[model samples]
Target chain A: MKFPFLKEAITSLTKKPSTELYPLVKKEAPEGYRGRIKFHADKCINCGMCIRVCAPDAITRTIEKTEEGDKITFQFYLGQCTFCQMCADFCAKKAIELTKDYSMVGTDEEDFMVRGTFIKKLPPKPPVPPAGAAPAAAKAPAAAPAATEKPAEKAEDKKEEK
Target chain B: MFKKLIEKGIEKSPWLLHINTGSCNGCDIELVSVITPRYDAERMGFKLAGTPRHADIVVVSGPITSQSKERLVRTLAQVPDPKVVVSIGSCPRSCNVFHGSYSVEGPLDRYCDVDVSIAGCPPKPEAIIDGLAKAVEILKTKRRGK
Candidate 1:
């Protein structure tokens, strides 16, 4: 008896169907799946690293000078995003996160944007020095924060030399 | 009564016509895999039609390039009225990483209004199916002229 394909015939009968039936049974994206970008505005430091690293230019940041401070808003245009995760990697504050939500169907362009607004407090200005006193000017730089003291003196020195 | 039956059939089974402008083949491959036996999209009544004339929904993938601009327009014109245009990935929606390239002439909206856009470099198969299902719903509305 030549049963050329006998080994496969019985094996197929007991196996379950391979079709997923997605509409009826929902599936979950696995861990480390990069789907949608989630921005944590509070954690952001306004460094603009994410913007610099984005290959698609899908990220935009708007800085508005307000009485409160610099009102910085980041807009992630998901429609153009490549999900490359470069923006997330470059974010120093860990503000950018790509979630597992893959359902991205939408009719309007606005529906595809992710926006985050944060206010960065502007650094206080150093006190103005009197034009006549170079000695007072030396003390004036001390009024500013230690981080800005050296740069402030150097800037004033250039102005004086001019 | 016959019209009702036809509507039911249309709802159950929407034929899709896929056109690739200048994609990197990532989204196209996923779209094709949707029909494979493992996914078995046909079980849900979705079939990939051979031509635009027979299609109820058009699935467009890739960025619209200078070469494909006229062809895409012509293809869209060939699709019968009440057809739904589903942009399959980020490239067609906004040219993705290929934005501002010399050969790239578009984001899909530069030609015609995209009815549905699935966002991803190449969207997952499940997401593509989800977008297509939504497109079928929108097609029904467009057919009624609303």
Candidate 2:
């Protein structure tokens, strides 16, 4: 009887099973693992850089005009996401982050969506200039541009006619 | 009493039928790894079925391409009642980066209802296991209802 693997079998008898007890024992995804997306609405400047860089078009933005400011709502659809981290990489405000949570399992489509909202206040008007001064100040610049434009137009006409 | 016992048997061991409808092979690789020794998905009573008729859980990967759309629908229809449809990766759920391609026609829900969606470019093996566990739970509920 040739038992070629007798020594190997004896060594295997003492070895522990390689199978991971997955459900019973939870495991964490490694650091910098691009998984779920986290959008920081407050940190976002509404630059729209992330939207431009996203290959899947997973990020959607809706702007609503309100008394306070522009209410910008951004929706990140995880289902459509490729987990490429490009959106986070292009974000100028560091508003988007790819978390290490890999267990992004869900039944409903809504469950896979990540949303964030932020208001961007409009810039203040230039002190209003007291009403009377406003028209005069505005007229001065407006008239100056018109005056410069008329001369240029006349010169172009003369050239055309010649 | 025998009916209840049959249901119990079905709940304990739910066989999976993997269908790739134009996948880039990323999710397929991860799914194969899940069945390997290190991950060993079989320990949880999940087995890969050879045919759709024998499947209790249908794991669909990839964006449904124009060519594979018909076949995908036909395969799902064959998976008898009380079957759970699980979409692995962002491709099946929303077509991922392949959304606007002329050849791709998917986001799996258009054909059949997806019970569990595991979102990742190619989800980690652990995540795939988690999704499978959820599929198993859904399978139990479906079986009980039937």
Candidate 3:
């Protein structure tokens, strides 16, 4: 009962290594651990909430007009991020998420950037007769019946077409 | 063969010199934790050196404040050639939340080229170890250049 060394030795023998075998035997990050950022472009409404809440101003949004609509790109610069989780929390659509993967070692500046692109389609413009097309004398009489019957439906059909 | 063996040995054991340039001490704690038994970065032949002259890798933490800029430059100059500068945490890389502060001069890139930048407010212990491992590889190349 007085042999303290004997008891310590037995406990040490039975117990596994205190060290985490990282790089070989990987370990998982605990719950709510804020590490790398994940941006879901689809879910993002481009509200700019994440950018506003970010203390370090690590979040950036760039918009480009495309045939579809607006191509929005969000670049989360991890190098400038504080990992305070404010960006994820303030995101109204929950577009921003903090993943558990903490290994962010990089040889280049671009490696730490988390980028996502989403194209928001613009609503089709309503068709309007051009004033320049003043063939009214000849065209008016021919189109009078059809235009009067269902002009609204024809505009709706044009809106849906690719 | 002897030269190759020596290089291999040097590659295996890398002594790091930690420099604190007005850090919030968050990154510093995580860095110290890497050497503890739980993370045990020493098993990978990594160690914290007492002086910059003795270190193979320089681990810098915090944004370089205007006051500490000169000291940082002087300390870095003391480190011998073929040394790898590994910037740890977001503070050193981009000053994190401290960016644009009156006292904070800028990030580590202003002084010297950073070989490895581990980005986090205060990166996890494992991330620091991984960054150091990568620094060792970079050190190998620098050694060859020398």
Candidate 4:
């Protein structure tokens, strides 16, 4: 209502903004800021606690046994993620962690969702013995017992023949 | 005659005083955001007052820790009579994750009276404004016919 107040307001409006532009310009988040969890596939032990603690049932784990060992893959649905960062905190091996990249916008709901967020590396298994070794294992005991019985049986047969 | 005059004063202007007991700064930041360019809480005839003496509403954030109890008690005492207190987050409500800590000294009511509670880890900004509006309504009803 006052001329002085109006003049000050106009002058303030003409000045450059003091605050940084956000969302469009993209500000840097603080280090270790809890945003979304990224999985380190090779390091995961496949303990499955991350799946258990998820309040929304957003994670699913699939396990398969191979000649090598066990293989595990986990799928995470981002649409249901609450961004609570509880999953990363509870991970025992520190294989899962939250990163500060909050700019997750997508048109397709499926594309935005991250199913199979974790994969695990398995230890190499020992090789099976050759076929020849299996025959030796089966033949040794039978041959030893037969050798002892054959001499006794031959003596008995010789007496009867006499 | 004096009662009518006091009632009129409570309706036209309601000032708020904010106290932080101990929070992750999420609720604190959101509370400030309510006053910024987007929400601009002042348009609703609500204003942030510097001292408790000038306030009708007290907005509290965080779980009450041992370190914060004394300060909160002193501040609440300073606010004038016919006041309303609003607990702002899940921390003060159930203490959330910090519920069973050795140093936590609150459920808030142990120290002072609370009229309304807005429950969220850090409640959304729109919900915070809604809570404030509700508090003002309660203040109006309490003032009438007194």
Residue by residue across A49-94, what tens digits does model 2's lDDT show? 8889989999999999999999999999999998889889888889
Interface RMSD of 4: 10.9
Model 1: DockQ vs. true structure? 0.76
TM-score of 4: 0.50
| Worst 10 contiguous positions by lDDT, candidate 2 chain A | A124-133
Worst 10 residues of 3 chain B by lDDT: B120-129
| Docking quality tier of model 3 | medium
Ranking by TM-score: 2, 1, 3, 4
B11 Cα displacement, candidate 2 (Å):
0.3
lDDT of 3 by residue, B1-146 (tens): 99899878888998989999999899999988899898998899998899888998999999999888999999999998888999988988888888999999878998998999898878988898889888988998888887
> How well is each residue in A1-162 modelled by candidate 3, as lDDT tens digits?
387699789989999988888888877889999999998988988888888888898989899998889999999999999999998888888888999999999999899999999988888885666777657745886788777768787778889993
Candidate 4: tens digits of C-alpha lDDT, residues B48-101: 999989999999888899999999999999998778888776566546556568
Model 2 misplaced regions, further than 4 Å: A1-9, A130-132, A139-162
- By summed lDDT, the worst window of 10 consecutive residues in model 4 chain B runs over B118-127
Q: Tens digits of per-residue lDDT for model 1 on A39-83? A: 999999998888889889999989999999999999999999999
Strongest candidate by DockQ: 1
True C-alpha contacts between chains kept, each model in order = 0.82, 0.90, 0.94, 0.00
Which candidate ranks first by TM-score, i.e. highest?
2
The regions of model 3 sitting more than 4 angstroms off are A1-14, A132-162, B1-5
